[model samples]
Target: MNYLVCVLLIGVGATAVMDLWAIARKRLFGIPSLDYGLVGRWFAYLARGRFRHDAIATTPPIRGERLIGWTLHYLIGIAFATILLGIWGLTWVRHPTIWPALIVGIGTVAAPFLVMQPGMGAGIAASRTPRPAVARLQSLITHGIFGLGLYAAGWMTSFFYTP
Candidate 1:
């Protein structure tokens, strides 16, 4: 149905925008946002019904790892859609506001900078990465993209329920 297509399109568009932004950061500041090779591997593993986090970061991630990471990222976006649906139902689905997206996006940043980054040996906020400032910038940008995805998903749901 058209609604389904819209959901896919918006979710994918937001994610793609985020990814392209990452690539731009790499070229401009000399650091990769994610491992595209890894993303491809994730699809392959999905057929096998298994995904691995691999815990690799010193170098470019392998195909499988990036795939797993990206897959998880997408699924997370889908979850945000679930939240919108639960609260607002069909009506909320049709026209998701920017506030929810922005709040969720910004709110999600806490763990990575405070816990994950340091735990990963990145000092703080991924400061150990090739470009810390750039990494932080990418995080903010990517989270914003995720928020945009929430809005898209909600809008798509509206098309389906007509409320």
Candidate 2:
């Protein structure tokens, strides 16, 4: 139960980090991205009394499109904890630490900065951008948010799922 809770909390935290990432990206770099329409797309599909998600997100996903992005987002959190348990076994997972969450939360920013950004045409680490500094700043801000999210999610997990 605690493990499940941690996974969920981590997932939310990751989402927050991504949200902040978009803001940071826009503020730091003159780069363009999608709008709030993504929320609608995410929820709208669910609102139809179905578990189905939109085939095409309003704000098209960077890699593997919408389905892949959404699945990856949540799965990463679940998998992170799962992998931790797989390696350390249940004993380590029992204690639950913030550092692990923080590391995964913040570390994922590289996806957007180095991988996703470039794939999305933003350039490698913002190298092809007119404002590389701003691009780096955006990645930094997003990663910071992810770190905060990890801590927040860990606290939440401890509160709701911890013994």
Candidate 3:
């Protein structure tokens, strides 16, 4: 397996795992999943010279926003996988350690806390939400789950692309 192919598979697989967790959480805990449509709306606004919003949920619906958001979600996963592989190299990919994956996965929370949430008007780390602590906790847990996904995906990828 090519390095890029391995990375893509690992990333997509990990992201799928995260999505599954979201669905399960929603069903079992009655927690709402992050609305990717808002993500799509954010991207759509980029073309219109807008980058931030006070409340992305209030923003007008954009055409194909769902598609755009879902695509970006997977692409972002791939990008993160690239970052992981870049730092850890092929050795880590072959070995599939847990620490690096968890570190990278948890570190990803910064993107939402500092960038996404602020851009979507959820305040930093979801402080603007009605339940700030709960939101923050959810984000942490979700990212941790993503970290686990990364580890799982890495292990799976190693089966096909052994060092």
For candidate 2, what is the lDDT? Answer: 0.55
lDDT of 3 by residue, 21-93 (tens): 9999999999989889889999899889987898998899999999999999899888888888999988887
Q: Regarding lDDT, does 2 or 3 come out ahead?
A: 3
Model 1: per-residue Cα lDDT over 60-97, one tens digit each: 33446655667766665555544444454444445667
Whole-model lDDT, candidate 1? 0.58
Q: What TM-scores do the predictions have?
A: 0.59, 0.56, 0.97
Which residue pairs show collisions in model 2?
none
Per-residue lDDT for 67-143 in model 2, tens only? 54555555665555454444444344345566765566566667656655554345667676678887687666666
Candidate 1 vs. true structure, TM-score = 0.59
- Once fitted onto the true fold, the runs of candidate 1 whose alpha carbons sit more than 4 angstroms away are 1-13, 23-31, 36-55, 58-63, 84-89
Q: Which candidate, 1 or 3, has the higher TM-score?
A: 3
